[model samples]
Target chain A: MKPKLVIPLLIGIAFLLSACAGVGFRSDTSWPGLTSDGDTIYMAFNQAVYAINASNGNLRWSYPAEPERDRTYFAPPAVAEDGTLYVGDFTNGIVALNASTGAIEWGPIQLGEGDGRIVGGSTVTGDLLLVPSGDGRLYARDASDGSAVWTFPAEFNEPLEHPIWSAPVVDGERVFFTSMDHNVYAVDLAQGGQLWATRDLGGAIADSPVVVDSKVLAGTFGNELVALDADRGRKAWIFDAGDWIWGSPAVRDGVAYFGDLAGELHAVDIRSGSEIESWKQSLDSRISASLAISEDRIFVAAESGILFARELSTNEEQWKVPSRGTFDGDLHTDPLVLGDTVIVATNGGDPLLCAFDVENGSERWSFTPGGSDKRCRSG
Target chain B: MNIGEIWDILILNPMINALLYIYDFLGPTLGLAGAFGLAIIVFTILIKVISLPLTIKQQHSTQRTQALQKDPEFLKIQKKYKGDRQKLQEEQMKLYKKKGINPLAGCLPVLISFPIIFGLYGAIIRSLADSPSPLLEFSKHIYSSVSSTIIPLDSQFLWMDLGQPERFPIPALESIPIIGDGIPILAIIVVITSYLQTKLTTPPQPGSQGAGMSQMMGIYMPLLIGYFAYTFAAGLALYFVVSNLFAIGQAVLMNRFKSEPEPAGKKKKKAEEQPKESGVLSLLASTQESMMKLLGIPPKSTTQGSNSSESAKDQSEQSGKKKADAKGS
Candidate 1:
């Protein structure tokens, strides 16, 4: 080739080779979304669910016994009172695993053609497993046999085509949920009938609504935290966040604590939907996970993989745990508060599920899910 | 670090950070979707302005070569070394050295910009990653200044989702039985602008060695860019359209003011008597040529001699026939 032409062609070839080498670019490697039951910490990472000893972070057992192509878990496992762990996967539908043994109890259940991959953890309310799918439908399956109880929208004559991304908040007999269609839906759990849907909030809602008092408080793409009458779905109040809220607000006492995409953590009066002037704080990192509240402290994980623990009342930072392993990953899963230890994990390269002392943010035990550092990725 | 890691740290990361920085400022006022679309246009303009010097040099380099190809002295040397490919290459180098025109200058910029283009592509992908993992990777590149407005970037921009391939915004239009979302408007713009840019910068060289290659690039480049715009994110297609249009405008403006005239001399006058070559060769393959030069790489053309060789053989034949005809007279 002519040298003039050769230069570009060579660069093109180099790029092609680099692209080919990137075939294994696991940029989406699942982070540890933790679920705790007694002494076992059920950690979901990449493509498998692990049961780790809460004390040492040692692998106890893992579901699927190995990572399957269709079983990558991105959502945290929801543990029920009966020790059945309800978990969602990227490709595989919701699965029910024995919490202690990591054994498949009833599922890998298909939710409408099995392609409606679950990205949100299931809500195990009473006898039904409320699994949210990307297809905008919430599938209610029997917790015992994983049989279909009912699927919202599918039961309706004209099924809504919007994705129900956040896990449905089951309040009493009613399930309050948010959809990418930019509305909050309140439906009767048993009959699968939509009781009411609020007016278009002008933005999509990807975070779950917190049922505080009689209001369903949810954050939205329009950078507004809207409070609606939980029973009638009446719009009560709206607080403009000035940035998209990817993480749902955590309500404590009368204040609603939430972080916006701009890294500003706001404390709003849930009753009035107004920001509390003294309680607002800016962390300067993307916060995409719900705030994990424990006792008097509120645990928040940023997309920077840093976990911040602050006093719930004063909004004063107690301690901040810098990202473990590589700082490239995000802590999408809410930090888990188990007694004195707070567990959190990152989602990118060498994802580390680390446990820190809640009081001082001291590292306790860290675990790597997919690496060959330790055995037992499977149960 | 490996090649992939190196690419991310150096090229992809910087592009992502720069684009996001632009997005962060515009997103708040324009809405997330509009912010991304506007950011791409602004970024394209920034890159164009940064490489403006090379753009002017590429134009000057092309014009000088066009003048050289028509010189009688250059043609005489071409005729002398017509049969010997090696001797022709040596003589061409000497001629180029004497004239002080770098044949590679036209293309060095274009070759250099490829990494930036690839980096921009990677940046777009990373920034639009809505999922947790990819979003996490995107966070590492975020500058502290724009760190807060980084996530949940509104993908919806007007009628298109900046993150996904653009489709018709109107439901009725999109539901048009067979057409299904009509055509991608940005992709169409990319194709037209790309073709115009290619035509303006690489106008068909009638009888040069690069004619076939130039013609091939003219068709393929626009089609390739159009295909990407059709299939990839609307934000990327928007970038393509803006950059191509900017280049077409720049080429027109730069070519209007030619570089300082080559000092006139005896050798230059003798060269003016020769038949002017039809094709004006340029290494302005794409916007990337000058970029490559900025990175300190001179993309030399081996075909410099070959392009002239075909014309050299013809000249030799014509001269031989002229002598025979003179003897007959």
Candidate 2:
């Protein structure tokens, strides 16, 4: 070929390669959004959503059959009582699939005028599915037909300045959501009107606000865990976490347990916004995922791919498991504990899902979509 | 530190903080709706201004190289050492040294520019963190100077989401089957501006080696950049468009002010030889010539001009020979 032609052809090939490798505006690195419906676990990863048998970690079915370019699934699949799975994609598309068969029941419905992306999972509230979008609007869609029922702020023109990257939590008649705009909002679930929005909390909230004891507990990037009046959206109190908290606190009883990006885990009394003494522990890596609580233990997954289970009563490390091999295994998703098996999803790992015995952190099963020899082992 | 860490420290982190700071100031203080986009524009302009000296040096170096390529002595040296690569390089270096030109001077700014550009691209992507993991990673790169309130920079600017590839949806055009979804307006603009910048900066020399390379660049650069604009985030595309426009303006201004003046005799001769076309027709013809030139297609008028210059050279040579003969007699 001519030299001139060769250079352009080379560039064209590079672009093709980069596109094929998913090198775009956003880096293709995210923890799998894992959820369980008791019998089965549904995982939304990079390109497709997979339904695995909760018992043996065997793949039951994957949606779309073939992964579509530009369509990535990251939000956890929200399974309804009737076994209908509602999920959202990075492309602002929401779809309802039959959980048993992985068949699309409704939509691939494009939301937010094809601009906003669905980063957070949808919450199924009776007949309404509340979806927090990257466009900063909490869309309440009809759970049956996927039709738009109402949008938060009610007014179509006014949206929160920043994206809502966390799911909305429903507390009775109101839906509470934390925004990257540094404000937590309470919207009337039925009318989708804003009841109240909290004053700027000094940082962006990237996780769902946990409601316990009539208080909305949220961790912020401002290095503080803030509790607000769940009924009125007023600031209750703030406990400095000393670092940015990326994950929501897993509340058990009146104590809220959470981890910060600085790798410190704290058990705080949600009522007084005071740190529970002797309940703090530090990990080698950052804790970017929400903690999972079982009957006697709380499972914490760190960014270093280490999963540590601590006894709930004494906050002592029960067992620690490190993801095997050199697989860019980073745990940034909240682990789900079902029965005796505690399942953890990894970011950029060979085994997308790893299950361990809740008692001793023994490997139960490892599931990688393409099949891998690696296993999670106790260190 | 690893390469990734080094990159983060040297380029990515600083850029992210810069963008965040700018967004925070512009959005709240100025009350700009598309504050993030404005921040990117301002950032790009600031970078261009900071690197102005380097850019000007590169431009001067390029002009010098072009002038050298046209020099008769340089052409003779090249022909003499056509079969001897090492000798040709040595002679070229000697001539370059004599002319006080650094052949690699033009490449220095370009090499420096690439990192800054890629860093900005990284910054744009990192700053507009849409998902949890990326957002988590982004938080680590934030400097203490940037306020925590500006954690999530608004990615929306006008109709474009700065995070995604840009496309403009025309409702009226939506009925037109193929392009119903949206048109990549930014990508199209990128291509046009890229082509224009490449063409305007490259001195047109038809049939020359430099011309062939320049022509190839003119074709390839736009397509390459256009593809990126179409594929990557709208913010990066916006950067490309703004950067290309800035470069073109700089080149045009430099050409206007720093171009070498023609001799009075030649200028007079050129004026006398000009075709007396009517006003409107001449204006239209001139526009057509300019368009052709901008597209890197040597205009017919320019070819005629080249012919006139060659004739003038021949006449001058003949006159000098005659004077030498008269002195000999």
Candidate 3:
């Protein structure tokens, strides 16, 4: 590495790998996913779902993600265009967040301990949701209000394998979901009809599937890239990375990108499953955080407390920015980049929500949910 | 139970109340009970005492190794044969035999302490469960069996509930902004004081490799810990600030008493460096050179000169007076 080139290279690599590097949030209570509908940005916390202004990071409103009495809340909240936010909680059913206000419009959709995945962000399509759950059922919940639209029973009965591993992917009118049971489902959005299901991709599919055109691209704990046809629910192409792929894959244009536990990020063509660009950057640790994608850029957040931003086209380094603390050991949040500011969250230390100026990689503002030292004094 | 009573059962119970009670049976004046700085002070003292014998052993082993390899000829042989593993091992054993240096002395205590900390953690969890510990089956009884419910075993000095110190009233504090409640000023003071505490206690280590190792800890460790202290329970932060101060005091005392060897000709180098500084005010003129090193850089201003430049104006006056005297003479 040349003297001038090393820092730039490290900076670029760090950004892609930095997002997943937080230690666990202050408690099991944390908002793991942040998503928006242009004007409103919704974050799921331990017991509440917070809505912030997308432009200024201001508090628009906060809705409770969990039951009123129970402490459990959804880790991620999903936003739908019809002004409904689909949120999950461990104890209560998934509640619908009013798009304008951070208020739950109806009683939450309750999940049994078997249905607790009612707390993660699910892909929303019209009135249907292919909801992944901890109880092993991937439910199709009504997006309008908290209603049990339908649920696909798992092939197996084991609890761990049954729990929802990651959020589902929606391609066209079909929804795709992967689970710990090592299965992927492609169900029709309108009728909750099972088009096809593929589960033999080897390891668990904790990494949510990313949809590119007609194919759903998913990485497996099995360390293999399994692509399922959105129309058929059959195998499209599988690229084996020879390491555990714990995080979700990102799809932009026709390239699907993701890294394995072995720390190799791959950019593969969605059509043929052929590797387009493969870049290896060693952070000397494991990565389980999901990959976030913009139109031209791909960002992977690592558990090493570093975020690596890479140019999607070239797979080249762009910038690496570090946070003030370690993200939770498990990287649960997926950051969304809006223009120059990338709104990201870490569960470790005190910082909860941080907006980074994408151009200079400086923090625009830090929004902490009251667990930092700065908040300790009467200040 | 109030926060103090809870903390008393958790952290204070096992370490302070229990330890003091045991010590009391041994003596008449166990005056170490119920002090503000007691927990941080005593635990640090225990760590120092426990590590002393190992520290002495490490010192002797290093000294002995130096003594055996004192001969330049043998050292030259080892350097010459550095690539040969067999030769290195032979040289190492020969030195060990000659100097009686145990190869594995330094790692023994650390390896043993891991289990001790683990056990203590288990005990802390059990105590904090508001239940009895499994190990010292009686520690449950110790908090329960011991008569007295004055502090609720969880009282804290301020907003902190010492018993359950992890959860402070951080949400409430940040809610009260500086403009409205005048708490942000206090928060700023706390951050600065603890940051200063972190800065003073943690000396700068060397090299990027050292920095890499220190990336998660060492210098950054104190800051990270201080950060948690600032945000976490006040009792823990109070414990940490007092602890660092105690550690600094102990380090200073130990350094004065032990006088660890510096560069062999350090005095000569200081004499050499002073002459080199005589002409170069540029090196010390900037604020970058004057301000103390911190984890994050201070707000930078290119226009401001360092204090050394301000002092340079004063020194020039004395020099000018001397020049006048020389001209008069």
DockQ per candidate, 2 decimals:
0.10, 0.30, 0.01
Which lDDT value does model 1 have at B43?
84
Give the per-residue lDDT of model 3 (tens digit) for A237-353: 889776666677776667667776556777778889888644445554455666777666677776555676777777676776663444433344666787777767765435667
Candidate 2: Cα lDDT at B164: 76
lDDT of 1 by residue, B1-329 (tens): 79877877778778778887788788765555578778888888987888777776676678667666756667778899999999998898888888797777888876777677667766776677645455445655665456453455666567777766876645656667645756688888889888778776764356777776777677777877787788776877777888888887686445433322332563366356544443332324323443433335656654322222223434444664576468546
Tell me each candidate's RMSD, in Å, in order.
Answer: 10.5, 5.5, 24.9
Model 2, span B121-158: residue lDDT tens: 67776776666766777778888667777667777799
Q: Which stretch of 10 consecutive residues in model 2 chain A shows the poorest summed lDDT?
A: A17-26
Runs in model 1 lying further than 4 Å from the true structure: A1-26, A113-116, A155-162, A322-329, A349-351, A370-379, B1-72, B75-102, B108-130, B133-329
Fnat of candidate 2, please? Answer: 0.38
Off by over 4 Å in 2: A5-29, A104-114, A141-149, A155-157, A323-327, B260-329
When only the first chain is scored, the TM-scores of the models are 0.89, 0.93, 0.80
Off by over 4 Å in 3: A1-31, A65-69, A112-115, A154-161, A277-280, A323-332, A371-379, B1-329
In model 1, the Cα lDDT at residue A100 comes to 81
Candidate of highest TM-score: 2
**lDDT by residue (tens digit), candidate 3, B13-61:** 4653443333333222344433222433354456456655654555445
Ranking by DockQ: 2, 1, 3
Give the number of the best model, judged by lDDT.
2
